[model samples]
Target: MADNLRGTSGPCPACGHVVAFDASTSTDMSVETVEEAQNVPISFTRPEMPEEVMDMTPMVDVVFQLLIFFMMTAAFSLQKALEMPPSDNQEKTAQAQTLEELENESDFVIVRIDRDNNITVDGEDAPSDQELLNKLREAKLGQLGQGVPGRTGLLVLADPQCRHETVVKALDAGNAVGMERIRLATVEDTAF
Candidate 1:
C-alpha cells in the first residue's frame, strides 16, 4: 500500500535530481506516482520560419564590368618589327675584326670591299669584281641553298671609304642568288 502522506519525494525525470512534491491533501501519493507524472512525453520542435533567397544579378554585372575594363586596357599590336639576321655560332669560329678573316669560317663566305674597291674572300684577293660576284652566286645556289630558311648568307665588310657603287654591287650579287640575309660590319664610334 502507498503511504498516506499528502506529498511525495522522487528523482526528477528532466535533471535526475531528487525532488519533493506536496502531498498535503486527504490521500497520500507514492514517489512512483510523481515519477510517472514527470515522465510524460514533451515535443521539442522549433517554430516554422520563412526561407530566404539571395540575388545574383548584381554580382554577375560586376564580373562583366571587370572583363570589359581588362579588355579595354590590354595591348592590341606591336609598334615596330626588328629584322635582324640569325647569329652564327660564336664558338665555332675565331672572331675577326672584319668578316673576311674569320678563322674556321666553314659556313659563311665573307666579301670584303676595301677603300680601293679591291675584293677578297678568306684573305685571297679576287681577280676582279665579276669573279667575286660569280663565287657568291655559286655558293648561294648550291652550298648555301639560297631562299630556304636557315640558309647561310654573305657577311660583307665594306671599308669606310668604299664607294656606294661597290655596296650596291654586293647587294645585287646577294639578291641574284635569292640570299636575302646580308650582314654589314660597322666600325665602333662611327656616327650613324
Candidate 2:
C-alpha cells in the first residue's frame, strides 16, 4: 500500500483520507483530513542559473603579432639611383642614327647573334666562347693599329628570338676583350 502511494498527494482511493509529505524532512508521512490539508501552506524555490563570459586577450595578441610581422617584412622605400650629369646647352647634340647608318659605319665591329643563339663575329661563325673572346681581342688589337685606341665600337645585332642570357654572355665577352664602346641592335621579325 505504501509503495503504491509513495509519490501521491491526494485523498486515498480505499478510504476518505488525505496524506501530506515534507521532502526536507525524513520519509515519514503525515495523515490529515481534507479540510486540514487545504489549510496548510505550500512553498517553492526557483532554480539557479549560470553566468556566460568570453575572453579576447589571446585573439587580440595574435592579431597584433601578425600585424607587426607584415609591417617588418614590407618594402617601404626604393634604393638609391645612379647619378648622371646634365646635358650641355651650348653644344649641338647629334640626332639618333638608324640601324642602316650604324651598320654602314666602318669604325664598328658587327657581332650578330642568329635565331639559333649562335654567336658570329663579322659574319663568320665562332665555334666557342674562348675562340670568340680570342677573335674579339685580336680585332681590338688590329683596330688599335688604325689610330683607334678606344674608338673602335662593338655593335651587337641580335635576333628577337635569341635568349637574353646569350646576349649577356656576348656582352661579357666583349668587355673581357677590353672593348669600351658597345651597342645593341634588335633585328626586325620577318615571320609576319
Candidate 3:
C-alpha cells in the first residue's frame, strides 16, 4: 500500500512542517515507534571510517614521572664552578686598578704548596684538606695584618712538580670559606 505512493511528494504528516518529502526516500516516516527506531542499525551509502582515537593518560603520566625523577636527581648533584679573569684589554685596566686598591686595603691570605704536596698557610703547616679549610676560614675571619677583621683575597704559591688535584683542593677550600679573590702563581723551590 505504501508503494502506491512511490515517487509522490507531500507535506510531513508527523510534525506538520510543510516539508516536501518523497515517499521513496528514507525519513522518520519509516520509523514505527521511538523505542524501535533506536534499535535499528545505521546504513551508510559510503565506506565506513575506523575510530583510531589515541589515549594520552599514560603518556602524560610518564612525562610527569620523568620530570619528578630529574628534579629529585638534580638536587643530589654537586655544582663546581670557577670564575676566570677578564680577557679584554679594557677589562684588564679595570682589573689592575682593583688589584691596586686591594693591595692598599688588605693583605692576601697566602697559601703555599711544595712539590712534595706539603701545604702551609701563613708559615703554618696544613697536614690535611680539612685543616686547610679550617685555616682558610680562620684567615678569612682573623686580622690579615690590617686593622680590618678579614681578608677577602687568597694567593696560592704552588711548585711546578706538585699534583694538579692538590692545587684544585686548595682552591676549593678557599672558595668554601668565602674567599672572593683567588690567585694562582708558580714558585721555584728556593722561593719557599
Candidate 4:
C-alpha cells in the first residue's frame, strides 16, 4: 500500500527536490537573552589550577613505604626453632626449658612486654591491655581444653627498659586468666 505524507516520490510544491529533511526538535533562538542584550560585562574569574601536571614523586614514595611495610610484616617460617640454653641456677634452668623439652608438656602461653609497653603473644603484637588479657585467656583456655598432661605455664619476657606499670599490667593480665605458673624472663646483666 502507498503511504500518504508531505512528500512521496516526485517533489515541487514548495522548493523542489526528491529528498526530504528530518525536522529538528529544538525551537529556533534568533533573539538574544537579557545578559547578552547588555554590553560585554566584566569576565568572571576562576581559581587557577597548576599549569603543569602534578608530579607523583611524593605519592610514589608513600606507596613504596607501604610496600616496604607489608614486605617487612610478611610472615615466614623460622629456619630453626629457638631454644633457651640451661642457666647456671637450677631454678632458672628448670624454668628456662621450653614446653617442647618437657616429656608430658602442655601448650604454653607466651607474653612479651617490650620497653614501650607493647605486648606480644606467640610472636603477634596485641593492640591494647584488654586485647592482651583476652589473648592470654584464649591461650590458657586452649591449653586447658586440650586435656594435655603436666602443668600449663605463662612465660613473660620483659625488656629491661620496660616500665614497672607495664610489668604490673602484664602480671594483672596473667592473674585475670588464673595463670599462676608465671615465669619472668630477664637479661642476666640488666637491672630489674
Candidate 5:
C-alpha cells in the first residue's frame, strides 16, 4: 500500500503507470491576493532530539534537601560559653583588680601559663587537662564567685607569647569544674 502511494509500484491492473505530480507547480495564481499559493504539507514524523537529554529537576531538589539537612545539623560552636554579666564602664572599672592584688590574696587558684605554654597551678605543674581540672576543682572547693568581692576565684596569669588555644583550654577546664569567677591577665602589664 505504501509503495503504491509513493508511485514505486509496477503498472496497475485497472489504469496504468503512475505519474509524478506536484501541487506547487500549479499554473494558476491566487484570485484575490494575486500571489503564488504554497502547498501546506501533512507530516507523520517524530521530532528529532538527543538520546541522552535528561531532566535535572529531581537532582536539584535532592541537592537542595541535602543542603538544608546539613545546614540544620552542622555545628557552628559546640563548646559551652561563659555567662558574662552585662555592665557599664563604672561596674567594669569597679570589678577590675590588678594581678599584684590577686597574687597577694589567698582566694585565687592562680593558674599560670608561661611563654612556653606550661601550665602551673599555684606553683605546681599541671601538664594535662585532667590534672588542671582536678586542681581547679580542688582550689574552688567553697568559692561561690569572683570579683572585687571577698570570694575565691580562678586567676589565669598568662605570658604574652602563649598560644590562644592553651588559654582557651585552661578557661574551659576552669568552667568545667564550676570556677565561675575566672580572671585572665598577662604576666606583665608592660608592652614592648
Candidate 6:
C-alpha cells in the first residue's frame, strides 16, 4: 500500500517506462538543501538608533499648579492665648517655706465653705456672694496697702461634706476679686 502511495510502481508518462519514485527521499532532499544554505555564516549589522527625547515641562507645571492651588486655599489661623507678665516686685528665686511658716503667716486669708453651703471669711459668715466678693476685695486692698512683696494668697477650706457647686461658687468669688494664688484645703471636720 505504501509503495503504491509513493508511486514506486507507476509508469512515467514522458518515457512510457516503469518508474519508481520515493516521496520521502524527494522531501528529505529539499529539506537538506535548505539546511545547507542556513548553515552558511552571515554578518548582522544593527541599524542606527534615533535619539531618545522626553519633555518634563508639562508634568512639572502641573505639580507647581497643584502646590499653588493648595497654598492659596489653605486656611491659616492665629491662636489666641492669655499672656501673663512676670511680677517685677516679687523675687525671681523661689524660697521653699516650711509648713510651720505657712501656718504662722499673718497675711494669709482663709475662705471656708461649710456643709450647709454657707460661705465664711476667717470664721465669719458671709450672708451673700456679693458680701464674700467684697470681703475678698478688701483683703486684696489691705495686702497692697501693707506693701506685701507678693500676691495675696487665699486658702479655700472646704468641708468634706460640702457640695461641689458651693465650692465652685467660692472659688469664682475669689477669682472675681483678682486673687491669683488660690489653694484648696479639704477639712475632715464632721461638724457643719
- TM-scores of the candidates are 0.37, 0.48, 0.50, 0.40, 0.56, 0.43
Model 5's TM-score against the true structure: 0.56
Overall lDDT per candidate, in order of appearance: 0.60, 0.69, 0.73, 0.60, 0.68, 0.66
Candidate 4 local lDDT, 59-80, one digit each (tens): 9999999999999999987553
Q: Write the per-residue lDDT of candidate 6 for residues 80-184, one digit (tens) a residue.
A: 332244766677687866544654576666777887778887667787888888877877777433444444767777888889988887777777777766777
Instruction: List the pairs of residues colliding in candidate 4.
Output: none
Q: Model 6 segments beyond 4 Å from truth?
A: 1-101, 143-151, 190-192
Error of 6 at 61 (Å): 50
Q: Given candidate 6, what's the lDDT at residue 21?
A: 43
Cα distance off (Å), candidate 1, residue 163: 0.5
Order of candidate numbers by lDDT, starting with the best: 3, 2, 5, 6, 1, 4
Best by lDDT: 3
lDDT of 2: 0.69
Superposition error at 110 for model 3 (Å) = 0.3
lDDT of 1 at 162: 77
Query: RMSD for each model, in Å, please?
Result: 16.5, 9.4, 13.3, 20.8, 10.8, 15.5
Off by over 4 Å in 2: 1-92, 143-151, 189-192
Model 3 pairs in collision: none
Of candidates 4 and 1, the better by TM-score: 4
Screening candidate 6 with a backbone cut-off below 3 angstroms (N, C-alpha, C), the clashing residue pairs are none
Q: Tell how far residue 117 is off in model 6, in angstroms.
A: 1.5
lDDT of 3: 0.73
Instruction: Give the range of the ten consecutive residues with the poorest summed lDDT in model 4.
Output: 1-10
Give the better candidate number (1 or 6) by TM-score: 6
